[model samples]
Structures are given as structure tokens and as C-alpha cells.
Target: MAALGLSGCSSSEDGGVLTVAGSTTVMPIAEMAAEQFEEETGTKVLVSGLGSSAGIEAVQNGTADIATSSRGLTEAEAATDLVTTVVALDGIAVIVNDDNPVSGLTMDQLRSIYAGETTNWSEVGGDDLQILVVNRDEASGTREAFKKIVMDGTPFDRSAAVLPGTGQVRDVVSRTAGAIGYISIGFVASDFTSSTVKSLAIDGVAATEENVENGTYPVSRDLYFFTKGDPSGKVEDYIELVLSDEMSQTIRDAGYLPLSDASYQARAKAAGAEEGGDAS
Candidate 1:
């Protein structure tokens, strides 16, 4: 298997397109980054939104150059020469229909709701209506992350609607009355703005750049780009380019928080700080 994005970035490296797959939650940032990379370098970067597991699988099976993910690969997924790179921090937002009146949720409340214990909007200071739950499909890293943080290994309620992709989850919650879902902050479009559906603070903490950066937010995690082994050739070049200060700016605009100068500088300064470093 081939790995990419470190040390070997000769401008004259192969000009062919590199295939990437993973997290829909990371899709917007990946697309924008790829667009800029293509414009500046004239090399293609094709990204797919097939969830994190699929992306890791794609790399492990020799089908992709990079795998983008909002969650880290499971230990089982990183066997052999596979390498993992963390690119940015993402704040996971709890979303409900605009009609819902809740402004925040305690972590315990979130767990109860997703686990189907709190099934009424009234239970969380909303309209007295049955609460509808929308969830990401099993393959989603966002799903796993949400589960890991909120559910604590407890099973999600079988009755909760498990939808595919972040887009789908957003759509369902936006349309369904009393619906609630979790999505990346970036996807909270204008339609959701000023709507009855609003983002809820988790554990009394809001999901924001300030909160995420200071580690005040309860639902935040590193975003990733995975490859097989140490990156070399064009892969190394691209990953290096992404770690630049300019790229961190892109990270913030993509609705994730940028690593601080100190944080990013330390990361960049590390040896072999490719896509597979401890925190790429």
C-alpha cells in the first residue's frame, strides 16, 4: 500500500490525481482544500464522502492515496503500515428543529435522549411533543464519536432513525417537527439560521471556535487524513502544504477550529510530521 503527504514533496513529483475517501463531515473542507491545491499546483485531488471506515478501508485496500475522517481510525483499522494524520479540530453541534426551544443540553440529557429515555421535547424545555431522534448511519465516524462521547458505549435506541450521511441527518431534523440530530457546525446553513431548530450547548458548553480551542466544549475532536505507511512523493508534498499557516486558515473557514500558532508550529516542527504523525 502507498502512503502520502510528507518530506518527499518535490514540485516535479507525479502530476496525477490522488483519490481520497471518508467523512462527509469533512467533505466541505476537503473539497475546498482540494480545489485550492489543484489551482495552485495543477494536480488533482479527488475526495469521496464514504464515511471514515470506508476511507480507511480504501487505503488499506490500495484504493486511495488519503482517507479523510472526523474521527481516528480504530486500532484494528491501523494495522501494518497504515499511518494516520490529524488536520483540524471539529466541534460537533447538537441540532434540533427550529421549532424546538431548547438552548442547551447536559451530557447526561443528551445520552438519555439518544438512548430513548427522554422522548419528549418537554423533557428538555421544549414544546410538549414527542421527541424524534435522527442519527448517523453506523459507518459514520461522527456517529462513532458522538456515541463514544455521549453514549459511553451504551447502545443507541433501536427506535432512533439511523440515517446515512451528515446531510441526510440535517435534512431530517430540519424537516421533521420535534426532530433532533447532531451535525458538524459547518453544515448548519442559512436555513437553520434563525430557525426554530437551533444548536444546543453540550454540558453547558457551546460549540464554537473559542470553546473548542480552549477545550471548553464537551464535543470536539481532531479531524484526520490517513494513509498507508509514511507518506512520500506527491503525498508528502500535499500534506506538507496543508500543514502551512495558510491551510490552518482554511481549516477555520471550513467550520472547524484551526490549531493555535504554538500548537501548529509544534506539530509542523516535529520530525516526520507527515499525514501520519501523532496529530497531523
Candidate 2:
């Protein structure tokens, strides 16, 4: 993953080929946007999912034109020359195997479960099977967001099986009968009945796009595209395309929450109010 953006320069020399690398959570939208941008314009965009931190590092090291991050930047990171733009909002869904009967969990229950305090499904109103905890690796932005929002800074159980990406988490939870994991809601199948893993509501709030848009979901986070400096030329045009109405359907089709004009303005205002605050 570290080698992903090592060869690319922040500025494209041929007036094409934008290099983007970052969060797997943001990779789908970036790829979709890239394809659309490429077709509409002549610029070619290359994208990679190399974890959030690595993405930022790529930008800082001049290896990438843009860095995608699921979580916001920290104060130290924000203080750097890099600039961040909020592209969308996403909900982190807590998922379990479809065989698990449990439909919801309170915040406390979720914290306890991840902390290794509750080891049995029965303790959470499920079948009497031993719980299998699946976690994201340390480099993942999803893992960082989950730890901050769900665990409240508590460390995950050491015994939890840590995987590298959201896809792996979903795959593991789908196959392991008692497994529990978390992923961006965008990766979840819209046809829940056919999906092998089921997303659980947290504290009665469902993990749906509508819920995220309405601010009713508890585990939502902003997605970002970071630039080493203010963008120009094709890079600037690409960012405009991503934020424009042209990409609204693209965002939804990718299973992410698309911001309306009002929502976008509101988010921008809120972000402005918190400038220099710790993000990731």
C-alpha cells in the first residue's frame, strides 16, 4: 500500500492522468467520478485504495494529486499545507451475519461487545452462539472512525480478527455465522433480503442513506478529497465536477449519500466553523 502513490507527481505533466489513492470507503465514489470525468473531459484519472493515512502521505510526499479520506484530518494534519474538501457524508454500518437474529443494539452494548465484555450472542438477544469479532486493521479510516464514534477511544479486544479493508470485513461477517464487523453503508447491498450480512440499527436509528441525510443516524462521517495545495487546471475542474449536480446520481448509484445544495452549504459552513480542529 505504501508504494501505491510513490511514483506519481502531484502535478500531472501531460495535462492528464490524475493520481488518487486513499480510503477503500471512498474508492468506489472516486473511481466512479474518475470514469465520468475522463469521459466528459480528456483527462485520465488513476485511483487506488491504500488506506487513509497512506493517501494523505501520498499527497504530502507529492506522489498523488488527490487523497481520499473517510474521516476528517486531525489538528496536526490540518495544520499542514494540505487542504481538504468535504465531498460526501457516509454512515458506518455495524454488520453481522444474516443468521444472527439480533436487529439492534444500544451504544453501550456495542461498546461492550467490541471491548470483549460481552462474549456471547445471548447477552445481546441473539442465539446462544459465541460471538466472533472481526475488526479493521489499524491503517484503515473506517477503523479509526469506528473507534472514535462507537468505542469512545476504548481499544478493541486483542483477540478480534483484524482485516485490511471493508470488503474483507463484509466477506468475513457474511460467512462466519457469529461474526460481527463494520463497514461503510455504501458497500451494503440495497436488497437486504439477498445480502449475506445484515446491518444493525444503532440505538433505534437505522443505517440508511435517508437517515444519514436527515442526521438521524449515529455513526456517520464526512468523506474528503485532499489536495497538497489549492488545485488548478484539470484537477480543479475534476473537483468541480465531483461537487456539481452532474455527480449526484453517480454518488447515489455508488450507494453513498449525495448532498443537496442546501446540505452542501450547511456542511461547508459547519466545516468552516471548525477549521483547524482535529479531524481523523
State each model's CA lDDT, in order.
0.76, 0.84
CA lDDT for candidate 2:
0.84
lDDT of 2 by residue, 56-151 (tens): 988898888889998778778889989887788889999999889999999999999999999999998999999999998888888888999999
lDDT of the structure predicted as candidate 1: 0.76
lDDT of 1 at 205: 87
Going through the candidates in order, what is the number of backbone clashes in each?
10, 4
| Model 1 agreement with the true structure over 1-280: per-residue lDDT tens digits | 1323321231223546767678888877778778888898777777778888887777787677778888876777755677877777777889987766788989999999999999998887878899888988888999989988889988899998989887778777888888889988767664544433468888888877677666678887778888888888767777776766777778777777655457534534552355445535
Error of 1 at 205 (Å): 1.5
Best by lDDT: 2
Estimate the TM-score for candidate 1: 0.86
Clashing pairs in 1: 5-235, 5-236, 6-236, 81-229, 85-275, 86-280, 97-197, 98-196, 98-197, 99-196
Residue 8 error for model 1, in Å? Answer: 22
